[model samples]
Target: MRNLTVIIPTYNQKDLLERAINSLISKCNDEINIYVLVNNTESNYIVRNKNYANLHVEYLNTNCGFCKAVNYGLRLIKKSRFIFLLNDDTEVINQIDIDNIIHELIEKGNIFSISLKMLKGNYPNLLDDAGDMYTILGWQFKRGNGLPKELYDRPCEIISACGGAAIYNKKILDEIGYFDEDFFAYLEDVDLGLRALMRGYKNLYYPYISVLHVGSATTGGKYNDITIRLTARNSIYVIYKNLPLPLLIINFPFILLGYLIKFIFFAKKGKGKIYISGVLEGLKNLPKFKEKRRENMRKKKISNIKLEWILIKATFEYFHQYIKRAFYTLRGAKK
Candidate 1:
């Protein structure tokens, strides 16, 4: 197998970050290089303490968020052809066949990214993310999240690979460009994956490679003010930056409806004000996103019809799933 670089972006979670690095070191051979991008911190504990043959660490004085940190790491790795992005909160529980996966990637010419089977660390039986899926309403979801592990038994093609524990071909990033720094964090993976799709590249969900992720470890556990605000804000940017003008116009109603429903749902959780603030921020940055949209569209190799086929046709199905999950959560709270 060709030499691979694993980039782990971490914030203030030094203990968890150390554990994550140790897990990789245990499983990875000398051929694998681990790059830990310590974002916005002065902590040199990991750099000083962990002494491995292939480990390297870099620190950024300013907090640049997940997107920028990963991009910075990509720029730093000059030797490796394959790059794997892993979350600092994740742990590698099983043995990985890196050579076999690399061979599979070579065999599949169109594949630019591979999504690994990520199981929730807390609940070993449940999945954290199988891959990522995009809807016509401009929503991106974690495929098979919180579901039984046995459900996803086969390898298949997916719309996008989750940035938490996915591998990417360097050539694809060179062509389609890196993660949008403006995204900061949320939905940025979807934006990159969508861009890859537009440029006639494919993403695959490889069930063979696996990891354990403690979801949302850095951002205060999924639905906090920061998470909601950034997610709401970046969601708009993704829609504007990726879709063609015609498709954007066609999907406007559905997008509006989706936001409306999201507002109501978050309101139930007392996050309506934060969510609305994010929407306003997103709307204010429309001009910036429009420029990005124009830049991305110029590189399109796939037609709107072909892209439409890949997108989820019925947007309501996702909403239904959300409502069902919410209902169960509410019921459990009452119980």
Candidate 2:
């Protein structure tokens, strides 16, 4: 039984994929296994040149979405205590000790999932997010979004994280279920993290290990109409499925206000009313999400009040004001 199984799910980002593979091949400390699932539709791309002569690399027969591709690899690996669902566009920069992460897991004995410190490529002061967080409303966000790199060293509990890079306890995943395949791309991590919290598990952000993220490499910075629609629809799914009564009451106005502001911003940016389109798609699927949530609540004895703080952090949209102010401070403090 090895300590970890590092899985990277990729589609069409060959250049970044090569760089990420080299970074991991260089820094891993123990005899851990590496699994890379190529989810590309076309027959070939010549993705691996690493000379990983000692690692495991597999390709799915068909191109499944992000969640399903990783799960395919999981079905192959027999035994791993911890599973690292890493992104193909991120690079591990430090010689992270797997023993330390495992030891911390034993010591805490409670945390179910986490993400390493994520610094944006070539922008040391800017953070991709130490981990993911949100409010009760349908606004999923990153922790320390524009905060200085120094603040990332602090370890804390977070609502959820960008699935691009995060660690999960295999046992916990089995308990709660795999990433909701319906969320083909965005907000899947948030949904999984929320499910665990609702069942009394904690998702944390750890800084002992660090990595550089080539953010949004696959979809580029912003997407075409389809990606935008999917993202909008999924964001609403997260809020609808995880929101509890108290936090919903407190944050409903904020959710509406946030989307209205986003609508104007997107319109000015020439993004064709995607905010409205996304909400409508979400509403059309609301009955499905509601049923899942009700079934989940029934199976787990924990009440929403016990998980209120997690809900608040999961839907935090108020942090944008802080982010704008902090970007200036970060620039001033940068070396």
Candidate 3:
């Protein structure tokens, strides 16, 4: 068995998939195996491994979105010690970076997940997202997003996981679960981090392991209908699945208020209907989502403290700054 398996789940990105595959081929040391999961009917690239060994491809029959495609592909891999997830639009920019991540994973032993620094494809030097952060409203946001590249250098612990280029312990994941099939695509990483964190496992960010991602190249970018709906559904479903009854009570108001603000923003962009539909559909589907949560939380062997800490640690302070700024602006205007 290989020390690690790099799994890239793809859908309809025939243009960039070859570059992504080549990127992996360039970086992976002999210790890891590369697995590509493709679902789209259009297969673009072919891999001829004369120089490199341990690289494999598993093509699916239908376009099963991303979550199912990954899970489906994962089931076929001979259960390796580590499973690294990289997106079809992302490329490993550095080889030493990947080596460091594998080193950390092996040394840590109990780490459930580790995310790498993801930079935007347009501005390869500028930071796209450092890792994933959880917000108080029970949502995940990419850290250091839109910030200058020079600022994000230190490795740290993150509350949530980033699926763009994250490595997972396969054994732990199989028991905890794979990506929630209901999530289809977006927010699945956040849901997985929440579920795993609830079990006392560590999810971290290794800044040294950096990669570049062409954001939304395969899926939604600014805000399309499918992205809107799944994100909306999963956002509400996340709070339902992870938050306790009391935290849930405290979180509802903020969640609604956040959506209200988002609605106005979407309206300004002429996509108001899309956001509204997502919110409404998410609300309508809450009961079933809640039941899913109830069933999932039962499988964990962690304390409620760790669960709450997951929320607190994963909490992104950036939004708190914006909210604070907004409140002060309102107060100053009143004064």
TM-score per model over all chains? 0.92, 0.89, 0.88
Candidate 3 stretches with Cα past 4 Å from truth are: 43-50, 97-100, 300-316, 320-335
- Winner on TM-score between 2 and 3 is 2
Give the alpha-carbon lDDT of every model: 0.84, 0.75, 0.74
- In candidate 2, list every pair of residues with a backbone clash: 134-313, 134-314, 134-315, 134-316, 135-314, 135-315, 135-316
Q: Tell me the TM-score of model 2.
A: 0.89
Best by TM-score: 1
* Candidate 3 local lDDT, 245-291, one digit each (tens): 76667667766776777778879888889877877777787877766
Cα lDDT tens digits for candidate 2, 236-259: 888777776566677789878867
Model 1 RMSD in angstroms: 2.7
Q: 1-335 in candidate 1: lDDT tens per residue?
A: 24578999999888888888888777764457888899877655555334676778888878899999999999988877889899999988877767777887744588899999999998877778888888887778887676668877788778789999999998778777899999899899999998998888889888876788998898988899999999999998888888898888887887888899899999999999999999999989989777678878998999998787677542454566567557756876899
Provide C-alpha RMSD values for all models, in order.
Answer: 2.7, 2.8, 4.6
Clashing pairs in 1: none
Question: Order of all candidates by lDDT, from best down to worst?
Answer: 1, 2, 3
* Worst window of 10 by summed lDDT in candidate 3: 313-322
Candidate 1 weakest ten by summed lDDT: 312-321
